[model samples]
Target: MKEEIQQQISDALGQLFDAVSKLQLAYPGKPFTPDGRLVGDIGEVIASLNYRITLNEGLTKHHDAVADDGRLVQIKTTFSDHLTFPVHHVPDYYIGIRLQADGSFEEIYNGPGQLIFDQLVNRKPTRTGLHGGLMSMLKRINKDVPDAERIPQR
Candidate 1:
């Protein structure tokens, strides 16, 4: 059973690698580094799939997607160990997705835009300075708004 599970895992990873490689090829001159924008694209795809949201493929000023209920969603994804929330445009909600090394992902935080902005405003160095990662932001949210609802990973 263990061997079978391992084989399944290996096959799934191989398929993912192949798909990512093809995607990399599609974007010529772009290096597929861990911290590259392509990884963020993957995160957006994941978020879209998980939330049943439609992505704004081309360049846009604000949110990444509009939820089923018509709420604007800004998605922030990180393959690295940190998360930074930009202070520019405010969406209806913010979805933070953390992609792990083992092909798993965590929805670190999914909450109201105003709550996130408030946390950022009070905690961040400047209005433009990026906020900290998952735990830090969560901590700030918990401290400030004890009754806020955070969407959990599905």
Candidate 2:
């Protein structure tokens, strides 16, 4: 039963991949794919990215392949029209990936690609019986560590 649910989520993510691709193509890179890490960081905001990741398909390769190629992305699959996405600090943290122009589920990163899950997660969309819990969590852990202080400001 859980496997089926995962597949359903994966399939939904695939469709969201297509939908986001069409949206971008229609607007000529105006919008990008959704971020999954943001959702995982918070609540179920994963469904907000307008995309989804296959629990069995794009997991291993995403971390090893795409990210290895100088990319960091969170894959989310869903079956809704809401275009919410989470926010993050790292470059590879919340970047969105979708089916490329050539019908491939490859991940991409850039400006719009950098919207962390926090930015898209609906504040009041239903949470752990609390509001902004996920958002707050993300904000809490995302505190900036001063590299200069650690290695001498000079």
Score every model by TM-score.
0.64, 0.27
lDDT by residue for model 2 over 1-154, one digit each (tens)?
Answer: 5446545666765686789889988898576746445333221222222233222233343231233323334433222222224332223434223332222232222222223433435544443332222333333333442322111110
Please provide, for model 1 over 1-154, each residue's C-alpha lDDT reduced to its tens digit, 9 standing for 90 to 100: 5346445544664676676688789996775546646667767767765665677877565688777666778888776667767656556777777776544577666777777776566564656546665566654564444333443332
lDDT of each: 0.65, 0.35
Worst 10 residues of 1 by lDDT: 145-154
* Pairs with backbone N, CA or C atoms under 3 Å apart (clashes), candidate 1: none
Error of 1 at 67 (Å): 0.4
- In candidate 1, stretches whose alpha carbon ends up further than 4 angstroms from where it belongs are 1-33, 123-129, 139-154
* Candidate 2 deviant stretches above 4 angstroms: 36-38, 41-154
Report how far off residue 107 is in candidate 1 (Å): 1.0
Give, for candidate 2, the lowest lDDT window spanning 10 residues.
145-154
Best by lDDT: 1
